[model samples]
Target: MIIKVENLTKVFKSYQRGNTFGEAVKSLFVRKPIYVHALKGISFNIEEGELVGFLGPNGAGKSTTLKILTGIMHPSGGKAEIMGYTPWKDRKKYVAKIGAVFGQKSQLLWDIPPVDAFYLNKAIYSIPERSFKKTLHKMVELLGVEELIKKPTRQLSLGERMKCEFIMAMLHKPKIVFLDEPTIGLDVIAKDKIREFILEMNRNGVTFILTTHDLDDIAHLAQRVIVVNHGEIVFDDSLTTLRNYLGVKKIISVSTMRPLPELRLPGIKITNRISDYKAELELDLSKYELNKFIALVNKSSTIMDLSVQDPEIEEVIKGLYH
Candidate 1:
């Protein structure tokens, strides 16, 4: 395994004051801080060259786990080893072998062009000139950001800056990269571009650990997903397995050639009716097979078109929380 964690945990201390002034004053001098267990003995491992999605709702300790793995924070308990190095204990050497990108943070100098930051990263990492040039060229080409590299960071669009961020993180060619919400605020086109670049990099043998609220990213990039809730590993399995486990229900949208007099079927509920000719129905797959349902529909109505869709990834994840 390229990454290993066992019984990893982190606790945070926070203080809360009373509503009354007198109570607040008294509590300030003699109050116990609240302890929040951000991570609760979560354990998992990732092999080399694998792309995995680390998913959870807000405050579920996803960021804490990423920070610990990237050497930014220490776990209060448990052990984690990446590329044979303990992250917090060996921060300096460990960082050199890995890369990280947090969406809300900026590693590039605000006033400087990305090209300048790239050069600075080269010096900081002590990357040989030949390797730096080759990597930079490939990154720029793959990202289609050759023209944006020379623009000041502030002048660039969110998508442009994000592409530069990826380049900076990958210039040294680290074995593992941690990306937290890499496409948080980009439009659909920009999101697709970023996903494409990530797929390309993974194909070329770079390991990626991605955390995002966007399920599209997971569907497109991850072969495996590890879902956490309330600081615990609630689900850890391949994407296909996840779908199968949660795929007892399905949505089918049908469009008929003409309006029908009446429509009824067992184990199917019409969720929406767009006129008499078009309707969306929810199917209970456990009670009815898909083929049989389709046959019934075709026999009853003149079908113009139909599409069967699995439940949305968000709903499947939301189910984990309950």
Candidate 2:
């Protein structure tokens, strides 16, 4: 395994004070402490060269786990081993074998050109000149950001800046990479380009752990997914398994010559009613027969058109969140 985490846990201490002025003033002298359990003994293993998606709603311990694994913050309990090294204990040596890119955080100085920041990373990592230049050129070329590197950071667009951010994190070509929302806000074209770049790099044997709210990213890049909620890992399986998490559920859109009947039936939910004659429903095959429902709908409304599709992936994820 490239990464193994056993019973990982984190707790944060914070002060709580009442809203009243008296309580606020009293809180300063006699503070009430609240312990927040951000992680509750989550465990998982990741093999080398596997692209996994680490996902969760906000405040669901996703960030906390990432911090511990990256060695920036110490966990309250449990153990994690990445490539046979304890992240928090092996500090300097561990970091050299891994890279991270936080979408909200910038590694490059705002006023300086990205190339200058690249040089700074080169010095910090002590990479050989020839290898540094070769890697930089390859990434820049793959991302089509050759000329953008010379422009000031502030001058680059969000997409442009993100491309440079990837280069900054990969200068040393670490074995593993941690990406947090790498495509937060971007046009469709830019998102596609970024996805392609990540796939190409993964093809070269770079393991990626991506945490993003974008389901598109998860669907396109991840072979495996790990979902956390309420400070615990609720689901960890292949993307296919996640899609089938709720069992056999399908979406059905129907248009008929007459108004539809009240879908007051088991295993069927009216998801959308565009009009009296046009409606969309979700059918759970496990509870109700598809042929029977079709016959009923056809008899009542004289079906003009009907289409069936798999439920959106979001439906599966939302089910897990609840």
Candidate 3:
């Protein structure tokens, strides 16, 4: 196993004050304690070269878990062992074997060129000159950011800067990378480039742990998923299992040569009626077979066009949350 976490826990202590100004003034002397349990003994393991996604609603302890694993915060209880090292206890040594990219945070110096920041990381990690240049050029080519690296970081677009961020994290060739909302803001093209980089890296034996609200990222990049909610593990399984968690279902979008009939058949739920000739519906494959449904539509309306796809990942996650 590359990562092993057992009964990890975190408790934060805060104070509660009053609403009124007079009460607030007096509350400075007397305050009620509020203990927030951010993590409640969560446990899971990850194997090397596995790309896993961490998902949860807001205030679901996902960030807390990542912080503890990255050695930024000491846990209140339980244990996390990454590559056989306790992250908080062996931070200096442990961090060398890992890399992280947070969408809201920047590691690049704002005023200087990204190459300078890359060199700084190279120095901090004590990467050899030959190896550093070798890795840098390879990533620059892969991301097609060779032109942007020499320019001031602040001048680059969000998508451009994000590409540099990936290069910075990978320079040291860490075994595992932690990504939090890595594709938070970007167009279709940028998202695809970054995803391609992640896949290429993973194929070469690098492990990745991703946390994001963008289910598209999870769908495109992750092989397995671990969902945390209410400071606990609610679901952990393969992406295939997650898609089928509710049941075997497919979204059917069909347009008929003529008008579409009222789809009141068993196991059929009309989600959207585009027009008299077009309609979209959900198919409960467990209750109704695909062949029968297609045949029925063909005979009645003379199907002009059709599409079948898995249920949205959002639906599966939303069900778990509620």
Candidate 4:
């Protein structure tokens, strides 16, 4: 196993004012704070080279778990080990072998060119000149950011800056990568590029634990997903298993060769009727397989266009929480 998390928990103390004036005055003398359980006994294992999705809704402790795993923060209780090292206790040594790109935070020097930050990383990671150059070249190429490298970080667009961030994170050739909402603000084209780069890295045996709200990213990248909700692991399984667990709903959109009257199938619910010849239906996939469902649709009218949409991963996670 590359990662072992056993009943991990983290508590944060929060203070509030006393309701009554007397109580508030007393609290001014001797204050008491409340404790928030950010992580409520989360436990899971990740094998080497496995790409997993760390999923949860906002305030669901997803970031807390990642911080603990990446050595950015300590857990209040239980155990977490990465690559045989306790993350928080041995952070200096542990972090050297792991790379992280926090979407909410930028690691680049804002006023300097990205290349300068690359050298800073080389010094920080103690990379040999030859190795640093080699890795830097490869990362820039893989991320398609060779031109962006020479540009000042502050001047670059959000998508360009993100690409540079990825290159810098990977410059040291870390064995594991923790990406938090990597594509959060990227447009569709930029998001696709980042997704491609991540898949390429995973193919080269760099394990990934990605946290993102982008269901498309999860659908296209991670084969396994671990969903956390209310500070607990609500689900953990392969993507296919998750789809089945949620009873994956399929959207069938049809464009008829000619106008057709209103219709309904037993397992299909009409979501929208775009035109006389076009209609969209949401089908619960558990009840009807794709081929069978399509065959049934074709029986009613001559089909011109049709597409089967799988349930988005966001919808699956949402189902778990709400």
Q: Which number leads on TM-score?
A: 3
Q: Is candidate 3 or candidate 4 better by TM-score?
A: 3
lDDT of 1 by residue, 1-322 (tens): 9999999999999887788999889897988689999999999999999999999999999999999999989899999989999999999999998988878898888888999999999999999999999999999999999999998899999989999999999999988999999999999999999999989989889999999999999999999999999999999999877776765889899987767445466678888898888999889898788998877777778788999998888878888877
Per-residue lDDT value at 114 in model 1: 96
Model 1: worst 10 consecutive residues (lDDT sum): 258-267
Best-fitting candidate, scored by lDDT: 3
Give candidate 2 regions above 4 Å deviation: 258-263, 289-304
For candidate 1, the per-residue lDDT at 96 reads 97
lDDT of 1 at 322: 78
After superposing candidate 1, which stretches have Cα over 4 Å from the reference? 19-28, 257-266
Q: Which stretches of model 3 miss by more than 4 angstroms?
A: none
Better of 1 and 3 by TM-score: 3
Error (Å) of candidate 3 at residue 311 is 1.4
Residue 313, candidate 1: Cα error in Å is 1.0
Candidate 4 lDDT over 77-163, as tens digits, reads 999889989999999999999999999899999999999998999999999999999888888887788888898898999999999
Clashing pairs in 4: none
Would you estimate the TM-scores of all the predictions? 0.94, 0.94, 0.96, 0.89
What TM-score quantifies how close candidate 1 is to the native fold? 0.94
- Tell me how far the alpha carbon of residue 167 in candidate 1 is from the true structure, in angstroms, after superposition: 0.6
Candidate 3: residue pairs that collide: none
Full-model lDDT, candidate 4: 0.88
